[model samples]
Target: MELSLLFEISMLLTSACAVLLAGWLLWQGQRQRAMPALAGFAAMMALWCAGHIAIVQQWPVLGIALVLANPLMPMFFLHFAVQFVADGSKPLPAWLQRGKLLPVLYGVTGSIILLSWLGGGGKVISSSGFSAFFVFQGIGWLNLLYTVLLGIAAHLILWQGWRIHSGNKRRSIVAMFLAGGWGLLLATSFVFPSLGLNWYPYPMLLLPSYLLLLVYGVVRYQVLAINAFANKALLWLGMLLLVLALMALVSALLGQLGMQALSAVPASQLWLYSALLLLLSAACYQPLSQLARRLIYPGGQLDESLLAHWRAELQQAQSWQELALRAGNLLSARLRREVSVQLPAAGDTATGLHILCRRDSSGWQYQLTGWDDVTPGYRLQGEVFAALLLSSCRILEQSLKLADAERKRLDQQHLVELGALSAAMAHELRNPLNIIAMAAATTPAETRGHIQQQLKRADRLIADLLSYSGQLQLQCSRLPLKPLLQTILSQQDWQGVQCQLKVPDGLTLYADSYRVQQVLINLTDNALAFCRNQAQAQICIETQHDNGDILLYVHNNGPAIMPQQHNSLFQPFVSKRAGGSGLGLAIVRRIMQAHGGDVCHRTDLGWPVSFELKFKQQPSALSTQIQDNIND
Candidate 1:
C-alpha cells in the first residue's frame, strides 16, 4: 500500500471525527449556553480539518473549499484566541467586532487560486510575476496586513493573559505551537507552489496540536465550557490531520518511485493506526494535581497542629473553653508537643472565645500561629469560627448574670426568714415578761419588796424586745410627755425614790402613750437602780426644745459610765447586767426610729449615765385615760 493513500485516509478520518465532535459540542450548548465562543471555536476546528482533508484528497472542487476555510482559519484563530484566552468573557469594541472581514480575506485568496485552477493552473503566478499569490495584486497584500495585525493583536492579548495568569505552564506549550504554525502559515502564502517548491503547501496543519491543547483545557478544566469531550475530540482530530499530512508526503515519494496505487489497502488498517495514536495522546494530558495536593498538605493534616496547648488556654474562651481543651488535646497528640491552653479570668465573659492556644516557642501572644479551620493562618483566625466562639461567650455571660441574680435572691430570702424568726421569738417570750411585770406590780410593800423590785428590771428588758420585733400592738397617738412622766412620778411607788422632774408642763410628742410610758418607766427604773450608795440618790427628768423638735433627758446622780462601750451598748443582745436579754436599749432605739426620732446615751455634769430622747413635734395634750392609767 502506498503511504500517501494511508495518509490521505487518516486525514479524512481525523477531519470526520472533528466534525462529529463539533456537532456534539454545538448540541451540548442548548443546555449550557454560557460558552458560545467555545462552540464557534469547535466549528472552526472541524471546518479546518475538513478543509485539510479536501486539500490532501485533491478534490476537483478543492479551491472552492479553500475559499470557505482559508481566511476562516485566521479569523477563527483570532476570534477563538480572543475567546479562549479570555474565556469568552471580554467585550470587544465595535470596530474590532466585525471580525468576519478577517475570514473574507482568506476566502478571496482561495478564490483567486480557484480562478487560476479553472483557467488550467500555473496562471495563479503570471509569467510577469505579478500574480496575486506572488505579489499584492491590488488586494493580496491585504491578507498580509490582516495577518500582521491579527498576529500583533494575538501577541498583545497573550501577553496580557500571561501577565495576570499564574496557571500551569501550558501557556508556553501553546505559544510555541502557535508561533511555529503561524510562521509557516505566513511563509506559505508567498512561497507555496508559486516558487515551484515540492514541499507541501498545507504543512501548517501539523501544528493544530497546539489548538488541541486548548480543547484539553476546556474539557479537563472547563476552560471554554462548550461542553464537548474536547480533549478526546481534539486528540482524534490531531492524529488524523498529522497522519494524513505525512501520508501525502509519503504518497508523493512513493509515486516518484513508480509504486502501485494504494486504494487496495483496507481503510480499517489506517483507522486502527490513527485510533491507537489518538488514545495515547488523550491519556497523556491527565494532570498530577491530586498527587501534588497530597504531597503539599501531607497526611490530611492541617497547619493549626503547630500551635501548642498553652496558647489555647490564654485565649478569651468562655463556654468554648471546653472546645479549646479538646483542640489542645488533639494537637498535642498529633504534633507530639505539650498543649497548654489558657483562658482569661474565670467568671468573666468579657474576654470570651479569644484563644491563646500555643505551641512551644511558636506562639503569637500565646495564640496559635498556624492555620486554623478556615482562616488559612493566624493573626487571622477564621471569622466564622471566631463569631461562633463569641456567641458562646455571650451565652456564658448571660448564664453568669443569671447565677448572680439568683444568689442575691437567695440572700434576700434568708434575710426575710431571719426577720420572721425574730418576730415569732419576740411574741413567744413577751407573755412571760408581761407576767413578771404583773407580779412586780402586785408585790407587797412589806414582804421582800427589794427582791420584787429586782424582778421588775427583768420585765423591762422583755417589754423592749416585744416592741422592736413588731409583736407589741402599739397604740399610736399624740401624747404629752411631761404629763405622762408626772403621772408615773405621782404614784406612791416612786415617792421614796426621790427623783425630781423638771419637764415643762404640756410638752407633747406623737407616740403610743403606753409604749412611751413603758420606755420612761424603764429609764427611771435603771437610773434608780444605779443611784444606790450615792451621797444623794436622785434622778432628774427634763424636757427641752431643739432643732424643730422636743428633746427629753433622764439624768441620775450615780456611778459614771466608762468612756468605752458607748453606742454599741444599744445593740441587740447587749447589756451592762448579767442575765439580761439585752433588748431594752435596742428596743428604745427601734421605737425612736419608727417614730422618726432617736435615743442615745450621754452624760450629765457629774459624768453620771444619762439617756436622751428626741421626738417629732405634736400637740401638748396627751389622752386623759393614759394619764389617769399611769398615775393610778
Candidate 2:
C-alpha cells in the first residue's frame, strides 16, 4: 500500500513538472527551432503520467488516451532531434525526408489498436492495490512494437547527431541522447508486468532522471534558450519553489512510509514547522542563488578583466594600422574566429564589430568572419564587450592621431631644411657645369661629346631635384584628352616603336595641363627605358570612366618591374637603372597628388609593365563636358 501511494505521489509531481517544462519550452519558440517538438514531447509525457493517475482513479477513457498517444511521444522526440541538429538555412537530412510516411503509418497502427480495444477485442485488467495495469487482447502488442521501434529510431538519430557535430552543439546532443535513451529504456519497462512477468515496475521512481538531464542540456548548452527566464530574481524564486516541492515530496513519502518521527507530529503543528522552514529558506536564498549563478555563468564577469587587459595593450599601439591589427587579433582570440579590421576607405566585406571612431573622424570597422560559431555565453555578453572594445579602439585612434600629427609636423620641418639645401646645391652645381661645358667645347670632338653627355645628365638630375622639392600650384582647365596625348607622344622620339592612343576624341580631363604633361612625359620615359632593347616594343595609352572618376592606363610591352623594387619605385633617390634620374616617378606621383589624383602600378592581361592614373571628377565647369563625354 505504501509503495502504491508513493507511486501515485511521484506520478503527480512528475506530471506537474512536465507540464510546467512543456509550457516554458513552448514559450521559448521565438528563439529555438527545436522547442515546439520538445515541448510537444513534454506535453505527451505529462499526458502519459496523467493516464496512469486516471487509471488509478478508475477512468478508463483517459487510460485509453495514453495508449493512443504512446507512439506519438517517440515520434515527437525524433522530430525534436532532427530539427535540433538541422540548420535553419539548410535542408533536412535525406533519411528523414525519405521516411516521411513512417509517422502516418505509426498513427494508423495506433488508431487500429484503439479501435480493437474499443470493439471488445482487448481487455483491461485492474488490480485493487491502487495500481493500474494495461493489457492488450488482440492487436495491442503491435502498439507496443511501434512504440519501441520509434523510441529506438529517435535514439539512433540522436547518436548519429552526436557523432556528426562537435563543440558545444555535440555536448548538447549528448545530454539529449542520454536523457531520451534512459527515459525510453525505463518507460518501456512499465509493460513487463503485463507480459506475465513478476516485476514490480518500480522504474516510475527513476522516471524524472531524463527530465533532469533535459534541464541540464537546456541550462548549460542553451538548447532551449531560457535566457529570458535567467534573471536573478526569477532564478532565485525558481530555486525556492524547487526546494519547497522537494520538501513536500519527501514529507509525503515519509508519511506514507509511516516513519515514527513524522507519525508522532500532529497535523496542526506541521504548519508551524513548514512556515519556519519557508522562512529559513527565504533567508538563505541570496547566497544559494549567487552560488547557482556563479556555477551557471562562470565567464559572465570575465569580460571585465579581459576588457581592461585589452585597453592596456591597445594603448601601446603606435599607428592606426598597428592598433587595428592588435584589436583584431584580440577579438579573434576571444571569439575564436578570423577577424579583420579595415579602414573606411578599404570597403566593408563581412558582418561584425563596427567601431565608429568620432575621435579619428574615420569609421574603423572590424569584420568577424564566422560569427555564427561564437559560443552562446560570449554572444550573450557581446553587446557589453563590443562597446568596451569600441571605446578602447577609439582611445587608441585618438592617441595614434596625435602621434601622427607630431610626426607630420617634424617631417614638414625636415623637408623645409632639405629643400633649402637642394636649392643651394642646384645653384652652385649649375655654375660649375656651365664653366665645364665651355671648357669641353674647346677640346677634341670625341671628348666634347662625352663631356656634353655628362653635363646633360647632371642638369637632368638637378631638374629632377627641383621638381621633387618644389610645391605644386595647379591652374586647372578642361583639356582634350586625345589632343593632349597626341601632342605629348609627338614630342617623344620612339624609334620604330608602336604607340597606340585609345583615348576618345571627345574625352576631356579636368586637371592642370602642365602637370598632366609632366606626368605623361615621366611615365613614357620610364616605359621606354625598360623596353628599349625589346623588338616590336609597344606602348598603349587608354582612358576609361569608373564611379565618377577617370582612369588613365599606360601599358608597355616591357620586362616587369621586380617585386622588391615596387615599394620604393616612387621614392626619391632610389634607382636601379644606369644614367637614370630616380626622382622621375616620385615627381610624377607628387604632381598627380596635387591634382587630387593617384598613380599606381597594375598588372593587366597583356602588359608586363602598367601604370594607372586615377583622376577625381571635379565639380567645376568641366561637369558638362565630362557628362557629354560619358554620354558619347
Candidate 3:
C-alpha cells in the first residue's frame, strides 16, 4: 500500500478503536458522567480522520466541512477531564467554565473561513515566485489562534485538577495529562501546514499513538473509571487478537520454508503442498497457544503447590492478626507490591489498599501500592489471591468462635462438678454442725451464740454455691416494685444506715419475688459494708423502664471499684471486703442470668458505686422452662 494510504488506514482504525472503547465504557456504566464526553471526543476524531482521507482524495467540500466540525473535539476532551476530576461536584473557576463558549465562536469562525475559501480570497502567496498551500489566509490564522487558546485553557484546567488531587486520584489525573499533552502536540502539528509547510504529515495520522496512550490510561490507571482488566469482553477480544497474530507468525515461517523446498515442484503438486501446510499448522496450534499463554500471561493462574503451601500457612496462623500478616506477605511477594495488613485494635492507625473481607466484627485490609504497571493477568491473579485471603480470614474467625464456645462449655462443666462437690460437703457438714450447736447450747450461752453465728455463715455459703450451680429455681411473677421494696426494707437490719426508694408505684418487674428480695438484700449488705464508716451512710434503690426492660439501680455512698477489677468482680471467691464471702455478687449475677436478665456495675448513677439489674419485661418460653427446671 502507498505510504499516505497506509497512514490513512491507521488513522481510521485508531479512531474506530477509540470510539468503540469510549462507547463501550458508556454502555457498561463505567464513569457514566465522563464517558459521554470522551465518546464525543473520539467520534470527533473519527470525523477528523475521515476528513483528512477526503482531503487526500481531493474532496474539498467534504474535507472543509469535517475540518470546520473538528473544533469541538478539544471541547469534548476538556469536558471529560473536568467531569473526571470534579466528578460533577467540584465547581470550576469562572474563567475555566467559560470554555463552553469556544465551540460557538469556532462555529462562526469556521463559517467565515469556509466562505473566504469559497470566494478564493484567502490563498497563501509564496515569496519564492511559486504558489503553495491552499488555506484561508486571514480566517485560517484566526482559527489557529483560537485552537491554541483553547488548548492552553484545557491544559491549565487539567493542571489545576492534577495539583488538587492526591494518591490514586492524582495518578489518574497524571495519566490524563500525559494523554492530553500528546493530543495537544498533534493539534499543534496542524499549525505547520497552515504556516506554508504543506509537506508536513497530516495531524490526524498521529491518532494511533494518541489513542494508544489514552487506552493505557483508561485500562491500566482507570482514568475514566474504566477498569479494562475487569471487562471480560475486552479481554476476550485481546486474546483473540493475540491468537490470530500467533497463527499468522507460525504460518508465515512455515510457508517460507515450504516454498523454498517446493521451488522445484510442479504446479500440479502445489495443492498437496498446501494441504500439508494446513495440516502442520493445525498440529502446531495447541502447543503455540500454550507457549503464548505462558509468555504473555505468567501471573494469570496460581500454582497448585503455591496454593497448598498458603493453605498450610493459614492453618498454622494463631490469631487474626497473625493471619492478616501472613496474607499481606503472600500477596506482596506474589504481586511484587508493598502490602500491609491492619488488625482491629484500640486506636489502630494502619490503612490498606482496599478492604478484602469484612464479617461480624472482623475485617481484612490489603495494600497494593507500587503496582501501577499491573497487567490484566496480574490483576486476575490478585483477585484469586484476594479470594484466598478472604477464605482464610473466614476460617480463622470460625476457629476462634468454636474455640471460645468449647472453652465456655468446659468451664461450665467444671463449675458444675465443683458445685456438686460443695453441695455434698455442705450436706455432710450440716448434721455435725447441728450436733455441735446442740452440745454448745448445754455448755454456755456465749459459746452457743458463737457456734450459731458460724453455723449461719456456712449455711449462707452453701446457699450461694447452690445458686452458682444453677440449682436455685425462680418462681417468676409480675410483682409491684413499691410494696416489695417497703417490705424488704422493714425486715432488713438497717443500723446507723438510711435507705431511700426511688421506684415508681406503677412500675413492676417480671421476676420471682423471693429471688428479687435476695438480690436487693445482697446488694444492700455489700453497700452497707463499704459505707458504714461514712457520717451519712446511704443506699438508694431506683427503678426505670427502658426499651421493654426494667432497670433497677442500687446506689451506695462507697468508693468506686477499680477498672482492673471490673471483669473479675462477679466471679466466685473474688471479694474486696475482708472476712466476707465473695459469693454475694457472684450469686447476684448468676440469679440475674438464670432469670433471663443481667447485672452490671455502673458508676454513672446516684452514687460513687452502683449495681444495675436489667430484667426483661416479658420472659421468653426458654427462660420460663429454665426457671421451672431450676425450681425442680
Q: Could you tell me every candidate's TM-score relative to the true structure?
A: 0.31, 0.49, 0.47
Candidate 2 deviant stretches above 4 angstroms: 1-298, 303-306, 319-376, 619-632
lDDT of 1 by residue, 469-546 (tens): 543344567677777887886753543456777877666677778767767766776676667546667888888889
How accurate locally is residue 213 in candidate 2, as Cα lDDT from 0 to 100? 64
lDDT of 2 by residue, 453-566 (tens): 999999999988887776556777778889989998998879777889998879888887887999999899878777777899999999989998999999999888899989
- Candidate 3: where are CA atoms >4 Å away? 1-310, 319-356, 360-386, 443-445, 496-500, 543-547, 603-607, 623-632
Better of 2 and 3 by TM-score: 2
Off by over 4 Å in 1: 1-3, 27-34, 55-58, 83-148, 164-191, 201-208, 217-219, 223-632
Candidate closest to the true structure, highest TM-score: 2
Candidate 3 per-residue lDDT over residues 1-632, each given as its tens digit: 24555555766677677677667656764545776777777787778667655665667567666665555676677667776666644566676576666467557545654554555433333212113223545555555555566566666777787777666656767887788778777766554555656554556466677865775574455444445443743555465556556555555566567765535443324433554565576568769987887788776766789888877886778787777777778767876765565444312324444334454544554444434567767766766676677677767778988898888778677777877798798789888988887788776778778888888987877777776665656777778988988988888777788888998877878788888888888888888888888878888998887898889999988778899999998988999987678888888887787677889998786578989999877756435434332212
Model 1 clash number: 25
Model 2 C-alpha lDDT versus the unseen true structure: 0.71
TM accuracy, model 2: 0.49
Whichever of 1 and 2 has more lDDT, that candidate is 2
Ranking by lDDT: 2, 3, 1
Residue 165 CA displacement from its true place in model 1, Å: 5.2
